[model samples]
Target: MSDLAITLLAGGVGGAKAAEGLAASVYADSTHIIGNIADDDEFHGLWVSPDIDTLIYSLGDQIDRQQGWGRKNESHQVLNELEKLGQETWMTLGDLDLATHIFRTELRKQGVRPSHIVHRLAKRHGITMPILLPTDDVIQTRVKTNLGALSFQEYFVRERCQPTVNAVEYEGASIAKATSESLSQIEKSDVILLAPSNPIVSIGAILAVPGIKDAIEKSNAYVIAVSPLIGGKTIKGPADKMLTSMGKTNDSKGVYECYAGLLNGFVIDDQDSMDATWLETQGVDVLVTPTLMSSTAEKAQLLSKVIEFALAHRNVRAA
Candidate 1:
């Protein structure tokens, strides 16, 4: 029954877990998620928004918990057929999951905005919380490696993120405008959370959009981020490897540095307590907790601590 309206910036499995936690909390109705669209791409003439759909499926409780993406009980018949036809099926879209992409592509063809499509998709999945896109424009993540620049999907899925990371870029972010809904949500929120997604590709791409970072910087809300790294490594994805490859520390302290000026506080795993004192020296409040959201109860527990931490900062900011 709290009055706080939370707007979360998120992407990938970690992001979904954070969103799941908040969706199960008392502030569920007041939570709005702004998801990354930079990881989006086309597969077989159908627009595939991986990060956005991950949020939708996860929040809808239809996600494949084992794979951490796509739908539960999904069939890959379509992908199998495509492979049989000599199509490069590295992306691996299940039959049921392809339906979402087809629907989204059709809507886009008919001139529907991406945000509106996401709203409809969420509603169809019985998700009550809002899922917002950072922009309606095409902003994609491009990874530059020694092998050459690859699309985020190519680097992530095709090569299995094995490329030696040289640089990461959001292709259209320099000119892309932030969606009105996303900016307004940030302004209206009492608390803003940066989910424990891949900072370089997921959260980084969101911030790369022209006005989103400015909106966060100017917001009066308490901004907090959860570190995806636990003891200098990620449970999923190549975030830790990317961080290290890009000349950044692969720990909670590095996560804080990534969002340095924007955050009022940071949530790290209890095992990373060693870095707490140094983080405090940099003038950011640190909250060390068990950030691994392995179970439903654990997700809720982590979010409960995060909420409490945010409330404390909100009070101080208000005072």
Candidate 2:
């Protein structure tokens, strides 16, 4: 067991970006992505897995770069038609993207779980990497906000994330069990990554699933998390606002505290490099590097820093 090699926990955009970095760093087949399923919802009788779809589209080169979601150059014919039919058009599903929902809904109707549906979809897109859903169960993230305790999509899409979130909860997580196959991958990984995804919603939702975090705690692999916030703001999404609403500052310290006990190491952006010494005082190893990845080269370099940082930590701890 030369440290069995790679497992990454991720959500959508931010997570997918960092995962792309890791994917390029290793043999794609060696990577396992344990993605967040809390954002899954049934739209117009079709099962839509937002996080899972983002990972696929990102890797498959179909992502809408400017929007940071949906397919690039996507058309909204299906959505427009649905609107004409008096359907709620709050959530936008593009024409090219509809093919995904159509395929997934059919499989799910035929009794396929989301995890398996995702695997089939990824393979169809020629992706060699393995992706594991944290659970095959219906564990969704619900935002306990001023508006209401709404499902992630309702709070995020239908209401446009305007609600003031008081807390985030994982619905159906208490009974949710981690899949054995996914657990085995965790057992085999050399390093377990906590992607720079929204910590409370994405990674938190996955950890809330019974048995998952316990396995990570018991595993021998190095657990690394990249901070999503840099200089009190997020690259994309309302993570900063979410943190503030939750009473955590929009800073690396808050993000660090979110995973303090679980993580063996953490990555902070170069802009927050000054915080490294302060973080080290808290007993968590810190790696300051350019966490932003606007291109393939930058992504690989960021991942390289992660690998380098982990190996260095191993050597120090072993000594």
What is candidate 1's TM-score against the reference? 0.98
Per-residue lDDT tens digits for candidate 2, residues 1-319, read: 2334778899899988977887677535567889988899999988888888899888877788887789898989889988999999898999888899999989888998778888899998877778888888888888999977999989888887799999888889999888887788887776888999999998888888888898898887888899998777888877888989999878888888788789889899888887889888988789887788899778878877887788679678867
- Compared with the true structure, all predictions reach lDDT values of 0.91, 0.85
Which consecutive 10 residues in model 2 have the weakest lDDT in total? 22-31
TM per candidate comes to 0.98, 0.96
Candidates' RMSD to native: 0.9, 1.6
| Predicted candidate 1, C-alpha RMSD | 0.9
Candidate 1 regions exceeding 4 Å error are: none
Worst 10 residues of 1 by lDDT: 1-10
Best by lDDT: 1
For candidate 2, give the lDDT of residue 218: 88
